[model samples]
Target chain A: MSPLVIAFLVLALLICGSALSMLWTKNLLHAALAMFLTMLGLAGLYVLAYADVLAVAHLLVYVGGVLILILFGIMLTNQTNQTNQTNQTDTASSKNHLMTRESSRLLPLSIGLSFFLGLFWLFTKGPWMNNLPVTGDSKLKEVGLGLLTEYAFPFELAGVFLLIALIGATFVAKNHD
Target chain B: MTDIPVLYFLWVSAFLFATGLTILLLKKNTIFVLMGIELILNAANLNLVAFSKNDPSMQGLYLSLFVLVVGVCEMAIALAIILQVYRNYRAIDVDQFKSEF
Candidate 1:
């Protein structure tokens, strides 16, 4: 196989494996770690797609910013008595409660695998537009210009929305009086 | 020019999308669910970017860029809400939440 094909395979494995691990693990921390791997794999995929800028941005946003935010959210919202570890009398009951997950197990997995395979087959068989050629050495300049000229309004709106979200988050997570 | 078929990227995206959907449906933990949501969003974004690579207008690229923004917004808002819910209910499991007797 070509180097590009091998790279794609590696990325796909990383993404798929980490996602599966994220689903399999019950420990919140482990799941978070799995998510980190998934994001890393995704960034690599973006780079392979020739979206170096998007790859970098995705790494910054998802891994650096969002993952940290998620970790904080996990810490802040942690249930003190999850599985009620300290109470000896209720240990068995709490263990049962803590171990149980809300998923459909085999059904969902089978369904998901089927959907994926179906889509893959369709993609391979379908006739797509192939006459076009890829262009642009890098998108840093084009994107900057587009954001300022074409997407300026929405860009500013996103900023305002972020501010609102920050304020709203504080309000929502505040200690109950 | 060694141009790979666009279908390869589409297949990858589809697999990611399906895995994400399973996670969304199967996981009880709120954060886990959120991660799944992110996966689905990224899978779709990958599709858009892949298709846009060949397009003269590069529409899919722009759309993916905006999708990234929207995903962040959703993540921030959802995590904040999850934090509040945990504080109130003392549990992050979805099945624990019951509105009325």
Candidate 2:
């Protein structure tokens, strides 16, 4: 086992374990923390795959942006009634107000397991281009050039789309009364 | 350094998709469902990046980049909507949105 493969295994374990913890935990705050770990591991995986630019972008977008958005969402939408009820009955756990409700677990877990197994079998059985020559180089320059030249139109479009979405989100979130 | 087989990435992504799907189904909180959606999106992005790792054209990389942008936009809009929903209903659980009909 080479160093790269070892790194991949460690990152993969980090990702999968945190993902499972996110599923297993009922506390919304715990899930958010788990998601942070998962995103970090995924960035590592992207770097391992030689998509360094994407990895950095992912780290910035997810860790810096999306996670903060999620934390805000959780804080803003907390169930005060549930917290008050728990506060009286369970003083020890009263400080933890981020608990979230979930449906019955058996069915979903079984379905997810079966779906994973099916995909596992399919990917392993399918004929794939395994011997392609590795082009292990940073793609920062080509990506920048392509974004400015060949992909200029779509890149500009994406910028406009992001602006519209942000404006619309603020508009929608504003109090209507 | 020997390149890691693309199959490994595929397997990991498949697991991620399944986990995301399960989270989507099992969780009642709207925010949790959104997190699941993000997981599924990242799973697909990983697949694209892995495929483009050996391709000189790097189309998959470009597409994944766009996917990431679109995903961020979606997340922003969805969370905004969720905030409005919580304000209107005073609850963020999916089951609480039952119609009177």
Candidate 3:
């Protein structure tokens, strides 16, 4: 396999493994950490796909913005029990770690695996265009121009949407006392 | 120039989508479920980027850019709503919320 393929495989493993661990772990903090790794691997995958602009944006929005927001959410929403605190120090086990509850794993795993298999079979059977190789290069200029010209209206609308979301979020989160 | 096959990207995206579905179904934490939603969204975005890789019009790429913006907006608002829920109920688990009405 070429180096590019090797890199892609490695990044894919990182992403899938981290996401799996996120599913497996019950500790809320551990899941958050796994999500961080998953996002990192996804950024790498975006790079391999030659969407460098999207890769950077993914890194900034997910790694920098969303993860911090998640951590803050975790910190803010923890329900501390006085009884569990003593037991936690004595045992030093994950039982005391802020738990994020889940339903039975067996059913979900089976369902997910079956879904994945079905999709895999479908993808393999589909006649996707493979003869044409991508004219691989940085898409920064094309993407920028497209946003400014043809997609200018939607682009501006997105900015407005973002601003509205920000104001709405702050209003919603603020103490209503 | 051996561009990676679109099928490979599709396979990975499918795996991601399934995993996200599992998380959505299984996890009780609201934020955890939200993370799963993020995963599914990214999977779709990856598919768009992969398919548009060779297109001269690059429509998929442009769409993915807008998708990213929308995703961030959703995340912010969802977390805010989660914060409000936690304030009212003192819990973040989806099942933990009990309605008076």
Candidate 4:
């Protein structure tokens, strides 16, 4: 195997391992940290796929933007009991702050494993496998040019959509009464 | 160095999708479910990037970029909605919601 393949394998292991940990951990903070590692591995995989532009964008959008948003969500939605004031002291610890509840582990794990195996078998058996060599050049210029030229309209639409979504989000999240 | 096979990317993406699905079903917290949804979206984006790596038109890459934008927008809106839900319900756990009926 080439060095590129070795690197790919290493990144894949990182991604899969972290994702599994995200599933396994009950602590929301631990899951978030695992997700950070997963995203890093995914960015590396994007580089391996010759999508350097995407790697940077994914890192910026996910790590910089989305992860922070998620952390805020976790902070805001903490499950503190109002009726039981006495127990509040016990639950106030940092260790118990964001450890959200989950359902039974056995069924979910089995279902997930089955789905993965079925998809794996299907993918390996599928006729869509392509042997074409990957173009190792940086895609930054082509992607930028394409967005301005061929994809300009969609690009503008996405921008407008984003603005509307953000405004609507703020509106929805504001105090009403 | 030989190009990495597209199959490897597919395999990883498939695993991610499965994990996301499991998290969505197993977790009661709305934010955890949202994270699962993010995982699924990223898995799909990875597939697009991998496929476009060898294509001359590179259309998949462009689409994946748009996918990223949409995913972020969705995340923002969903989190905002979750915040609102917290205000009304006092808990973000999906199973905790109850109707007066």
Sort all candidates by TM-score, best to worst: 2, 4, 3, 1
Greater-TM-score candidate between 1 and 4: 4
Q: How accurate is candidate 2 locally (lDDT)?
A: 0.90
Query: How would you encode candidate 3's per-residue C-alpha lDDT over A41-153 as one tens digit per residue?
Result: 98888888889999999999999999999989888887765435656665557343877678888898889899999988887776766444445788799888888999999
lDDT of 1 by residue, A19-125 (tens): 88887877777888899998999898777777777888799889998899988987776664635556647655553333426667888788888888888877776
Evaluate all candidate structures by whole-model CA lDDT and list the values in order.
Answer: 0.79, 0.90, 0.86, 0.88
Q: Model 3, B96: alpha-carbon shift in Å?
A: 1.9
Clashing pairs in 3: none
Best by DockQ: 4
TM agreement with the true structure for every prediction: 0.87, 0.95, 0.93, 0.93
Report the first chain's TM-score for all candidates: 0.79, 0.92, 0.90, 0.89
- Tens digit per residue, CA lDDT, model 1, B1-101: 34555666787789789988888878888888898899999999998878777765667877787788778878888988888777677778888877898
Question: TM-score (0 to 1) of chain B, per candidate?
Answer: 0.95, 0.95, 0.94, 0.94
Stretches > 4 Å off in candidate 4: A81-97, A131-133, B99-101
Best by TM-score: 2
Give the i-RMS of model 4 in Å: 1.3
Candidate 2 docking: what grade? medium
lDDT of 2 at A101: 85
